[model samples]
Target: MRTLILTALLATTTALAATAQDASNTLDRGNWQDAASLGASLDSADGYTIAAKATTLGASVSPDSAKAALLKKAQSYANQAIKLNPNSASAYFELARADGRLAQYTGILESLGLAGEIKKALVKAIDLDPKFDEAYVALGLWNAELAAKGGGASFITGARGDQVIPNFEKAIAIAPTTIAHRLEYANSLLLLNRNSNRSAAIAQLQKAVSLTPVTYWDKQDLAAAQKKLDALR
Candidate 1:
């Protein structure tokens, strides 16, 4: 009986690993929808987390009209991941990303409501994994966007302008060669205080443009970085 039980457990583990590998292969092939679908079908926290990430990545390239739906789907997957594994830092990070993207399509009050959720999720993700560079980038953007809104937005969201650059700098320090990290940092610098951060922003953009893109999303970010740098110069 013990031998049979051990064999069954090994089979289950192998199956789970196979599913994870297939999902990763689909992602590497740039089949975002397929990867998301495959991930959703798996019965594991890691699977749901990958599904959330794939859906979020798809939303980034989707039409504005379709983005909200994709983000919503990603949010659901992230929630499932967190439910299954509360300690998953990537799951919380994905939840934060989905909420941040959805905020773009919402009213001011609604967006502010989401800002709190985004901050909470990001903080949890960072607490779980201190090396989560993407969370820092999103946190920086959160600060920059709210501070840029001025008026009551910053005060209501508790977003301090002082936190923006430092968060981005932390992300860059953690992932110096990541194109998206540099591009986002440059963009957030401009958003926070363009005139004051113009030179620093330009340098980051230049670095982003110089980096080699390894994926479709990276290529898109690299192009954006180049365009922004050209405009700045």
Candidate 2:
């Protein structure tokens, strides 16, 4: 944060999309699977799951493979994209996202080390685009997850998870209607301080469930949000 944010303030906020805000316009789903082989030709959509609904949601219903092989494949594409354009914030963002997925499968100690890399990448993405609310959501998730870990875990990564609420609120402030921001904030609340924040979490989830979907990913998230809200209720 200190390194990347300092640099970003000095640098211009480049308007670039890491993942397609609207998939139809910028994302080409046809060649999505070819990202591994395509290398530098990767677009903002390359590293993300083509079927996030199936890949993520399926894991909830059944024990899907947890190898994170697809995430690593996506990482390769992000790596190539970074090599091709050093200044591409989207590339860095994808790389960070991939690292996060890998950490989920790899375990906590290894993921703790990877947190630094993820923080740097997300910070750089924000440096490139100050209004990158998605990046903020990612940042909030990072903090929230680490905060959930607590104590030595936070010290290891220099993460102030207690202060993660501002990150979530900042994203929500920037784009009030974005269900993702609300859903993620609700998650952070429950993860960090569940007992006290249960009501708040439900409130955010309520807003999230009521919102309309604007992208394919949004539909998946909305479904998850409703299920989660049901459980909470």
Candidate 3:
């Protein structure tokens, strides 16, 4: 009787395994490309997902061989998204981001022109979608980095600090939950306050360290900011 029971249990387990394998195979056979194409045709979230995945993969991959393939794929998806919906500011912004990442990987001077073009495209994106916080964030960073001599201090000051602070503040106002936006804003404030407001700069760096996420880059940046604040102290 015991032997018969063991035999039955083994058969049942084998049957269940076979059934699970069949289900897995069936799921694997589903046509993702067709589904994605349909989503693209209908202007659905799946299309955005595809583009976002491509962009993320492009950014995550190495700069060496076969990595360029991922970037090319990202470019293709971004272009497809833009083609599918010309009115989508997010699509253009994502395309610009992908291009910027690629430019960064491939010598800044070599791609400076492309970066400038992407910057211009982002401006158009903001004009099209004024409420887009990501676009504002990108514009703020670009302006901070590309600003003329003296860290664009003269230009930003002449503009009543609105040109820099307002853009970063707007991004923070729109997306209070995003730590990146806050960190970027704080970094910009630190630069702006270097000569005029050392105490304010230290405060901003402290806030940046406090608000940043616990990722590697965030932790590193937070540490650096804290170190600077300590030096000021």
- For 136-193, candidate 2 gives per-residue lDDT tens digits of 8889899888878978878888888766887888788889888878888898889888
Using lDDT as the measure, which candidate wins? 1
Q: What is the C-alpha lDDT of each candidate?
A: 0.92, 0.69, 0.59
Models, CA RMSD each: 1.4, 9.6, 12.5
Q: Which stretches of candidate 1 lie over 4 Å from their true place?
A: none
Clashes of 1: 0
lDDT of 1 by residue, 22-49 (tens): 9977876678999999999996888999
- Report the lDDT of model 3 for residue 22: 42
Tell me the spans in candidate 2 whose CA falls farther than 4 Å from its real position.
Answer: 1-63
Residues 1-233 of candidate 3: C-alpha lDDT, one tens digit per residue = 99999999999778655653443233234433333343334343336534443443434534466555555556666677777777778777777776666665676454555656667668878888998897887777666544422534334323234467678778878876555565566556655556665666566666766774544434545666677667877
In model 1, where is the ten-residue run with the lowest total lDDT? Answer: 21-30
For candidate 3, the per-residue lDDT at 47 reads: 60
Give the per-residue Cα lDDT of candidate 2 at 78: 64
Candidate 3 positional error at 167, Å: 1.0
Q: Sort by TM-score, best first: what order? A: 1, 2, 3
